[model samples]
Target: MAGTELFGTIEMVDVFLAMAITIVIASFVSLYRGIEGPGIFNRIIAVNVIGTKTIVLLVLIGFIYERPDFFDIALLYAILNFIMTIAATRY
Candidate 1:
């Protein structure tokens, strides 16, 4: 209802969907970096970046679907991602 009818022909949901797709593509690039990075720290940072992207993608999906629950899930994932990154760095 918020983004709808604002683009004259294109909807806000479409915009959000496009953003989500773009994020996915960027995540793939991060994945490549994670696999082919020259150093372990680079790989770890790439993985962390991917995780951050995932959280954003999740939020966009939740907005597109009009589900507040997704926000909570994304927040939980963010916490887990942070913990994992810290543990990986410590190890």
Candidate 2:
């Protein structure tokens, strides 16, 4: 039973890792959009999307690693991301 439980945990971690990788790839796409966007608003929105995805990725990584501190870091980063977006729009 313990072996089966361990295997299940491993499988879940694998799933989290795959999700993290997908988020990374999507972030890259957002990066490209930010670079080549037609307008300032479009670029700002792209950057915001990347930041949001990064927050999700951080949480996923924290789950996979069983690290509680990562959650705090993710939260702090999320606040920063939000402020940055607002500031970018204002400026």
Candidate 3:
């Protein structure tokens, strides 16, 4: 039973790590799109998506690291990302 529990915990950790890596890769792709996009609107959208993915990745990292403080940062990032997206669209 103990071995099974340990295995489950390890599996969870692995999954979380995988998710983090995926998000990071996605962010990089978004960043590339944002940089190389032909139109301003497309670049803005890509940047917004990158910001959202970054917030999610941050939250996931906090969970993996067992630090709740990082969640606050993630929340701030979410709020800022939303505001920036709105501002970008308006401009």
lDDT of each: 0.93, 0.86, 0.84
Query: Taking the tens digit of each residue's C-alpha lDDT, what string does model 2 give over 42-66?
Result: 9889988998998899899888888
- Find the candidate with the highest lDDT and give its number: 1
Per-residue lDDT tens digits of candidate 1, residues 1-91? 6666655898989989999999999999889989988989998899899999999999999999999999999999999999999999889
Model 2, CA-based lDDT: 0.86
TM-score for predicted model 2 compared with the true structure: 0.84
- Model 3 C-alpha lDDT per residue in residues 1-91, reported as the tens digit of each score: 1122335457565667799999999889789988988999888899888888999898888877778899999999999999998988888
TM-score per candidate: 0.92, 0.84, 0.84
Best by TM-score: 1
| TM-score of decoy 1 | 0.92
Q: Candidate 3: minimum summed lDDT over ten consecutive residues — where? A: 1-10
